[model samples]
Target: MKGNSLSQVYYRPIEAAIRWAGLLRFQHEIVAAIIDSRHLAVTLNCPRCDELRLYIDRIYDAIYHGELPYGQNGITIDDKSLWDSPDLTIRHVDLKRWMLNHYSGQRPAFLFSRGERIAHPVITLEAGNALLVEREALKSQLEQCRSQLRALQEQRKKHDQAPPACTLCPLSDRAEATYLHIIGAMLTLMLGRSPSGTPYSSFNSQEAIASALIAHHGHLMGITERTLQAKFAQARRKLQSAVS
Candidate 1:
């Protein structure tokens, strides 16, 4: 999204927002319903939206850093990969139909009692910021701690005669190993079919592969697709560092 002196909001396609919802802590349907881009873009760009994105980013950090959080149910990622599967797509259609039937998107909301119009819903920025500041501060402190932990782990590995890579990194578990396998499977699929009618793997796009795996193995542990992706990326970086 592009931001200017007067405005920061832009009408990204609803799909873009939905995909973001899949990655972040928010519900896709609620994000789809409330994020009135036309309304937001024309008006003063919300400071609230900025806070929202930052909030999501903090949650993203927690998930990718292998931290488990409790409480804050409203804001937790809950470790579910919300990929754009067929079931989710249908819900999108259903929500659109219900919204269209209930109200007109082209027009503003009418308050018959007060006779006021809210073309786009407006929220007080200060109140939301007040609620978020304390949590945000705590999250910042937590991120600092994680960075220190990683640094200490690396330093310890340098002097020691290597107990194990997993001990040094402290970044992998059985579940994460499964996620890594999913990443490898995605790569195999990207390689495509072999010559002699021997079936190999299918589907491309790492995000899609992770999502599909989550769908099939919902019983299996998972976090955000982006988290799985982050894990895959971390593995690659470590491998590259070793090779170089």
Candidate 2:
């Protein structure tokens, strides 16, 4: 188990080989196998679940599914080398075990979830492979940003095409609802700024505001600014009277 490549036990380890208990051997062993980028990506970015549990689950799944396994030991890159040369790729990550002695907290899982360095490197290669973790984190962030952008754009589109509610005049019934809508559309489209974000220096005249309303929504409303001038003037006078 010396290289980066995954290995089977040369075959499956027998029950005795796997179960032997001694200072030199353990029932379960973690082989420093490379996990796929996709699985690691999900584990890193999962929002609701415990991050430590998420990381553990990913590693366990890889082992269970045989993506990574405890390969045979003392693998050499060169078959002819007389000296002891262990393959760096599949090497046992036992080199980094010293970090564990530093962790005395009872809730190490929680600490690991919070990304405490006292956590084991086996939880993920995240400690060593910063770029891989960062890539996944940034990709997830980018997707969220794109989603928010899409929602904002949709809201802006609807807002541009529609008018805000008219609170100035509350007609009791739809008996004259058409006038309410006209006023609303006028106020929405011409006051201060148009839906297109255009600033207007003056849109005080009923004729001018009505003309803009008609130009924008004439076909759908089936009404002309000429017919609305009287109603518009009546509303304007009411507003002026109230203010004065």
Candidate 3:
């Protein structure tokens, strides 16, 4: 019906904002919902059991990856041998009507929400590859963080102090290290080179100290800047005492 417009559905600005920011791309199908090519929506399929079973996951994968993810289930089109089956026609239909008739059985009068749909450029294969690369890089950094945490733990053990009981303390230190690693990896991904002269050792040192304090205290040391400053001050005094 004249290409269902989201603006026609009427939503408050705040509701629209929350829907846009909070919705995951993978929850809906990506479709060009406008007459002229300005807006897009995550289309929901109607409730025919076969359509529901076949197209639901297809839509989700398309929204998530910016392209249709291929699979080879008996019901799916990717089963090349079943390409000629009459049951596998890919039809693009009116999203609003589909939701009304199929999802709600025409019960909910308003099928389209103004802010529920968002327009994004389709992700190219290169972009998907780049994401995979970043994911691998994050995993590698996580491993490095684990190794660094182990080394720090060993170092702390060598000193004349009781061993820590709080496991989260070491995990928090590892998370901090991983956070830096993620930042570095992002920089490398965007700039096509590693960031120059960032002090990896010093970065780990800060995390090590933070972890040590948390291990001793059994909680996040503090939230306020002043409180953190006090903790650091205390740590410095303790270090001096140990040396003396």
Most TM-score-accurate candidate: 3
Q: Candidate 3 — worst ten consecutive residues by lDDT sum?
A: 10-19
Root-mean-square deviation of Cα positions for candidate 2 versus the true structure, in angstroms:
18.3
lDDT of 1 by residue, 73-129 (tens): 123233434221111111223223333444323222211112322534433567558
lDDT of each structure? 0.39, 0.37, 0.37
For residues 20-39, what per-residue lDDT tens digits would candidate 3 score against the true structure? 23332322332323111212
Lowest summed lDDT over 10 consecutive residues: which window, candidate 2? Answer: 15-24
Clashes counted in candidate 2 amount to 6
> Which regions of candidate 3 deviate over 4 angstroms?
1-118, 161-244
What does candidate 2's lDDT look like per residue over 1-244, in tens digits?
Answer: 2222222222122211121111112112222121332122333332322433343443334434444333324242322231122221222231112113322222222113335434533433554386555556545654564465356435535645565563354546553453344444344334444333444325655567568657865663334766667666655555455446
| Pairs of residues clashing in candidate 2 | 1-72, 2-87, 3-89, 3-90, 4-89, 4-90
The residue pairs that clash in candidate 1, if any, are none
The local lDDT score (0 to 100) that residue 178 gets in candidate 3 is 48
